[model samples]
Target: MHALVGDAVRKACSELFSVELAEGQLQLQKTRKEFEGDITVVVFPLTKLSKLSPEATGEALGKFLTEQVAHVSKFNVVKGFLNLSMSAEFWKGFFAAALKQDDFGFASPNSAPHVMVEYSSPNTNKPLHLGHLRNNFLGYSVSEILKAVGHRVTKVQIINDRGIHICKSMVAWKNYGNGETPESSGLKGDKLVGKYYVEFDKAHKAQMKALIKQGMTEEQAAQQTAIMQEAQEMLRLWEARDEATIELWTKMNGWVYDGFASTYKSMGVDFDKLYYESNTYINGKEEVEKGLAAGAFFQKEDGSIWIDLTDEGLDQKALLRKDGTAMYITQDIGTAILRFRDFPDLAYQIYTVGNEQEYHFKVLFMILKKLGFEKADQCYHLSYGMVELPEGKMKSREGTVVDADDLMEEMATVAQEVSAEQGKLEGLPEAERNQLFHIIGTAALKYFLLRVDPKKNMLFDPKESIDFNGNTGPSVQYTYVRTQAIQRRYAEAHPGFNPKEANSEGHTLSTAESEVVAKMYEWPAVLRMAATTYNPADIAHYSYDLAKLYNAFYQDHQIVKETDEQARNFRLALTYKTGVVIREAMRLLGISMPDRM
Candidate 1:
């Protein structure tokens, strides 16, 4: 309906005023202050065609809009801007039509293109940290936004389950003397396994220091040559299916998977497909063989496999090690082949990974294109910058890594405390209060992680990130809850308040309410832009704007106290619609709004 009004306004401006209004030239913006009007249209772009000042151009456009646009009630030309007001009758009709539609705020039927988003590729050797949180947030939100805009989206995760890193954990677990298991230690699987990994580094360093004290060369004492030997031994044990080794590995990996599932559930991220490095590494070698046979790659002197990407302005990438084992790039290549074979018509394949691996994806795409996979050109690396703390980058070596599950738990505890302090848990049952805390906590984390542009590095200040006030997720959730509270109060006051019984008549528009209504009308535009740009931050920003406008309206106007019953009911209806939009918007951002928070 808003698009219809904008189109009509554009056509009327072009035909009646001889103003060459380009498509998308005229923007519908809310006035900077409440005193101005609802939807403002800047006519400065038409100054050249009208051969008049901007104020005069605005006056001319305002006249055309009022005279021709049926939905527009009136227009005021103010300082080079045309502030056009929608008739109350138009909003009533708009809401009526919207109520009839089953899928309001969803994209139209013409949007169809399959998008596959890959994220949360955590190594099995360690649990997810703060960085993985950002990756998952972006990936999950992007998928939801695309789905809201009528695109078929597939969320995927690639588990880096096999590598030298896994061997590090395995070596540590083997040499530590104690035959303890995660079940025996009663620690979360990822944390238990991570402890062993840290132990390995400590032991290796101690061994190197001892060797250095014995007057060995620096390189020799560093045990750099022995690192590969130890790694290979671990891999050999793993491949030979040593009973104790396989059992430990399987048990540890099982715990990590279980822990990850819980974390993903709390964060509202799920995968349609999961690719494991263990399953795909051999496949990568097979793909490399195929490429070599097809003249897409060449062999090194030492029996290693490599792909020359110099012609494409990229350095040559190694596909396989001299021992015929797959490397990191090799597994990715195999996965790409498998994915394309599964969904040949996939229009977009986005790898939501850290910015550190930007070059990896660049080379991967180029190699895929060179290997005759045309769909490689459509692949994108949504490279997001690192998430740093106030002090510096998070380093696991320094024991400064923020575990995903631990952070969530801490946030939930803080939310519970805040809820108690606000006396919001007065009559709620213990179970319900706990649930509310969880919801609020999850909302805080998801919103905080997603509010920033995905490509830019961001700080996750523990103190500031968890706050509910001031442009935070809790603020938006509180707005939603406040709207619900108003509806509840109104229902209690007028037990017979039936929406169908009240006619939206004599509902004169106040400046604040009009601004809210105008912003409300642009929900579709926000969704379209977010989906098309594949930027979830756009949705976050729009949701914040809507929340701010609605909160301002609530603060200034008394919906239930209005003398005109019809006006009160009409405002109630607008509040209801705003709640609906807020819920949908937050859902796309992978955040949930509590009914009462």
Candidate 2:
């Protein structure tokens, strides 16, 4: 539609003003809601060529387009804006064509850029949390959106499985667990391990307090705590591959992996490939040595390797400590290099990380580029804002964070409660009811998190997200279900009804119906914009608007019972197209729409 309008505007200019305008010079936009048109032409850009006032230029172009363009039925000049209303016939044909497409809004797979998205890098010490939920949804949705627009996307995550954090969980579990496994305790593996992590903190804090009571400074006390020292020694032993330490680490991490798999399944997010820090940290150390030999990094007398990024608006950062243990960036550098090597065709590598590490990514990318990895320029830090509860910021060590598993269970419980009150699916089988609740609850969670702009902090409210009337996942899902109900009844009344066989030519549409069709026409463009910005919020809002328009049309017009055959068929076709688009849009956000919710 945009291409058609662009060509019409260029032709109008050439014939009326004898001016040839480049495509970029001819600015076009959707007509403002208050305006009486489907597409708007910015007349101010062409006034110089026409040698007339803006309004006069708009009038001339509008007059020419109305006569020359077949789809453009009429036009009106509002100051410098030439608003053009497309023909009703054009909209009817547009919706009919849409009904024939299986992949309505997605572009065909092509030779576009192959991109890699990295997200959900959870630590093995604890279960996933609300923060991880946001990261996973955003990364997954962005990958899907990219694919929708013809980019080849690879979903990947680098698990932080080997670190001081993991060691903390192991050290506490071994000392105090008494061999309490997940099976014996009736707890998920991640939750069971997290309990020990909290225990470790409590014990370490107690020791620090005792040392402080002995007149030791806080720093001195922190270093002198027995629990802290033991954890540190455990880390050393694990790094040295001590048999006992390795066995303990392996057992605890296996539990975490099992727990994480369940949570990820419940969350409905997945990765195509997984990278482990245990496998990548050694590569990072080797790379650091190579950097040192190449003069890209320097080693101090204390045996710590450092990169001088002071000239890059940052202080020097350590690559390796005196004990030669790798830091966060060390593994990240190694993982990135390994990814590019594994997928040499990758044109972009996006790291979906929290904004707190913005500087870390900057230094990593700069170091990579300095070491002559020219592809480092293609690295993108998709820095998103944090998710905080209404009470306050979360503290993992204090165990205040919202556990992802618990939150999901709560959402399902809330969903079932809301579903029963609404009485929409009461007659379904128990198993189906349970499945619907899971779908709606998970969709609600994903939609609420993805609806906000990625760079903005969001306050998640479980109750608010599951509402049936407002802009939410369930509302959109309900609208789709409503459409399905209409289809079912229509089929009952007219058996063997095939929409493709129904003739919709020359059907006159009411204003509300036309509005619905107009919004549907905007889907492809909205999808493209979402892909370009790498923000699922764009698709989320678009889905809401499309659903809202369909609801309004459903309320104001007749569908299954309309006496007029042409009007009823056209409405059914519109309904069918709306369902397809809603499902597709929600799918791009990693959301599922239940058929009967």
Candidate 3:
């Protein structure tokens, strides 16, 4: 409809005023709530073509559109704006057609350029945390949104498995672990490794304090600490492929992988591909060598490799240390290249990392461009803000961060308690009841995290997220269930009823119906906007608003008991369409909806 109106306005200008208006010169918006029309066209820009007063220009365009556009029934001019209303037949036709489209908001699958999204790059030294939850959900949701809009998306993650961080855990376990495995300790593999990582930190700190007491400076103490030295030596040995160090590294990383698989399964996120630093760092080194050969990078006196980017408004960045170890940016470079190689038709490479690495990505992308990769300009850093608990921020080395698995379990527990208090799903079989709880819990978590704009920091409160009344996911889920209940009752009372026989051709819609139908008309545009902006918050908030609109309509009207069969059937059809949209929107967010609350 918007496109149609835009074209009509453009034609009106060319015919009436003899002026050609470019694409963006025509400004159109959905009529404001205070307006008495469906679509509003701004006449201010077209005034240049008309050379008339704003009101006069608007009047001219409104008359031209009403006469020329087929679906445009009438129009009115206010100030410099021309508001156009559609005919009843137009809306009826739209609603009837939309009813048949099971995938209305999504485009048909296309052989478009592939886009790769990398996220949840976790280290093996620690378990997944709350920050990782947001990353995974955002990445997965963005990929889905892109796919829905006809982009071929590949979801991937790079495990930070080989680093000094992992070596810290290995060194700690070797020095103080009494040979206890995850099975013996009754802890998850990632958790066990995380425990040793924390132990290493505490031990290193204690050694630092002792050296400080012996009159060494803090920096001196940090470099000279016994535990720190051991960790460093362990990293060097692992790099050298020492038998004992490599064996320990392999075993510990394997344990962490098992733990990660379980957590990922529980969280309902998956990756199409997985890269590891251990595999890609060497590739990065090769790329760095190629850069040096091409004069894109220079070798320092100490054998370290650095890229001089001063001309590009950045300082020199080190690609490799003197000891020949790849830096984080180095691995990223190789990963980007490898992904492009894997998908030769790739269009975009998006890295979902926190905001702190914004500069690092800037340098990495610049270097890739300098290295003559055409797709380097397509590389983008989806930098998002950190997530903190209500009390404060989280620290992984201090073991103060909330574990992702634990937080998910806690969310389910809260869901159960809330459901029990509300007395929903009572007397159901245990398995079915538990499934509902999980669905509700997952909806709550994902919606809460995705509701806020990804660029801003958020404080996730489980209590606020699980509420049944507000703009939460469980509330949306309950609304869907309510719609199902209405349909069930309708089925029981009128078994032979067919919505096609309702006949809504000439019926005048009430205010509630108009509002809801208007909202439904906005879904395709909203989804397209979300895909363009790479923001799931757009979809999340739209779902909430749609649910609220349906609930408002539900509250004001009695569906099954209306005396007019046509009106009742139209209301029932509205409810059905709302349910379909809610289910589809929640699915894009990676949330499941239960049939009953």
lDDT of 1 by residue, 540-567 (tens): 8888898999888888787889888777
Clashes of each: 0, 0, 0
Residue pair clashes in candidate 1: none
Candidate 3 lDDT over residue span 1-597, tens digit each: 988998888888889998889877899899997988999998888788799999999998888888888999999999988899998777777888887788898987764668999999999998999899999999999998999898889899999998889989998999999997999999999999999999999999999999999999999999999999999999888888999889999999999999999999988999999998899988899999999999999999999999999998789889999988988888888988988888898888889999878898899899899888788899999989888767668866545687789888877877898989988779899898887878888788899889889999988663454454598889889888988889888989789766645566556678888788888989999999999999999998999889899989988898989878678878988888888988888888999888888
lDDT (CA) per prediction = 0.81, 0.88, 0.88
> Residue 474 in model 2: shift from native, Å?
0.2
lDDT of 2 at 156: 97
What ranges in model 3 sit over 4 Å off? 390-392, 397-400, 461-466, 493-507
lDDT of 2 at 319: 96
Scored by TM-score, the top model is 2
Clashing residue pairs found in predicted model 3: none
Candidate 2 regions exceeding 4 Å error are: 22-25, 397-399, 461-466
**Whose TM-score is higher: candidate 1's or candidate 2's?**
2
Preferred candidate (TM-score higher): 1 or 3: 3
TM-score of 2: 0.96
- Cα lDDT of model 2 overall? 0.88
